[model samples]
Target: MTNYLIDNAGVLIGPVEFPVVPGLGVEIPSNAVRLTQPLEHAKPGHVWVMVDGLPEERVDYRGVVYRTDNGKSLLWREVAELPNTVTAKAWPGTHYYWTGDDWELDQSALAAEKKAQVLLERDTLMQHAQLRIAPLHYAEQLQLITQDEQTALLGWMRYCVELNRLEQSPEFPMNMEWPVPPTVGTP
Candidate 1:
């Protein structure tokens, strides 16, 4: 069994000895074998942002604005194009605006339309949430079921396990050993 050294405060801390070369500073214990496989990377554009608010909570025409990591307001325009007829409205003190074609409103009808739109938007969001949870359900099934479903379930389980291990120890080395220094005098 390989024993690895872990530095408490230095560059390499908490090192464990393993057959494989620890890619990063920390080492892996040789006895600790991988139990599961790694998860595959989600396809490009797989992730979607889910906002926590109602349509009324959303400013009309303005869509939504997000603060960028740079401390600037990444207005909706960054993710989508803006429409014409821009006007700002203050809601509960926070100003929101519409930058799109104005619609002539029959007050009551407009209210009903807004209500319907909110419901539709909520439904769509719920569907997206379901899709995101499906893979997790499959993984849970892998953990529970046996016999017939074992093989298929194991694949997903492995993927999840691998992904978690990778996250915990991203520095696990691919190669097992380092090259030895050549003897200077001996042939």
Candidate 2:
């Protein structure tokens, strides 16, 4: 189990002191509050502590922090519509910080968004891989070659590594067949 504490600057608007216990996972409701700012300076791996007992509007409200081994990280981007799960995009090295209240994005919230673009790039890279030469083709298939592409790929690779180091996974097999040597084209 992971342990975390509520940030000192993250007190609620009212005078009530939020209770935080060690080894507890904070639950943020789907509708009440959204994380608005990037809690970049907060401690690493500390869970967001939620308040208990409120109206139904406040029921099921919670949030938490997630840190990856990579240097890049961000806050829990969640919505009340999803009920209990908060979605976050983290890179290779990062830690979590709990910002008071739930956060919502405006037109200017591109600073921490990565998932959609990354997914699209990965798809594009894979499509490009299908037409390239072997081995070199396979390496390209699994990687993003451009600088920006590489940054995005590294984020995804880090996430996968944290979940289940694919390099060591037995189910992940490598293709050793070389592509047929190109014959003289009669073009």
Candidate 3:
């Protein structure tokens, strides 16, 4: 059986159970935590680290310090979240914090305030004039135009095309402009 202590820095001091092979019967190195066992329902002082939901080997959860050995080095890491602390998965959820009195949801009263701000912004955009759509009527008359008419209409868009390099050999613009694009969706 693996030996554990009930004292020290909650470091679990025990050898992992390894199966005995026919020819390989050598002992392997391991990590152990010396905890104040008699295993009470007390919070671990500083043994485990609770970073994510994924189980961590070298973390002290409650009163147990988990340890892991990856054949190379034994790791005894502490999770980011300490015991007796309230936490949440992400934003827009009921975030909890450890209050002196008890575990409280949103120690700061900013959850509803921030959510209201987002709703206000959304409503403002929906009521803006730019958001209203109008029925666009294409020209009913078939206007006869030369080949150059269509190209002239699209001249504003040609600022993006790379010039003075291709075999097509298009003439350069009246003046050189930076190759920057429109920050917004519209060109």
Considering lDDT, where higher is better, how would the candidates rank from best to worst?
Answer: 2, 1, 3
What local distance difference test score does each model get?
0.34, 0.34, 0.33
Q: Over the stretch 1-187, how does candidate 1's per-residue lDDT look in tens digits?
A: 2232322211111223345556676454533322122223333422111133111112223333332211223334322223332222222112222223222334455545554654464455445444444555675667754443444444444443443343244332321222222222112
TM-score of each: 0.21, 0.16, 0.23
Q: TM-score: which is higher, 2 or 3?
A: 3
Per-residue lDDT tens digits for candidate 3, residues 97-122, read 33433344663445455545544543
lDDT of 2 by residue, 1-187 (tens): 2222333433222222234556774554333343333223323433233445221222112344333223233443432332222324322222232232333333223422343444454455444443332433345587735554444445444443333332244432232222222222101
- Candidate 2 vs candidate 3, lDDT winner: 2
Query: Model 2's lDDT to the true fold?
Result: 0.34
Query: What's the residue-level lDDT of 150 in candidate 3?
Result: 37
Kindly report the root-mean-square deviation of model 3 from the true structure over all alpha carbons: 18.8
Number of clashes found in candidate 2: 20
Q: Give per-residue lDDT, candidate 1, residue 132.
A: 41
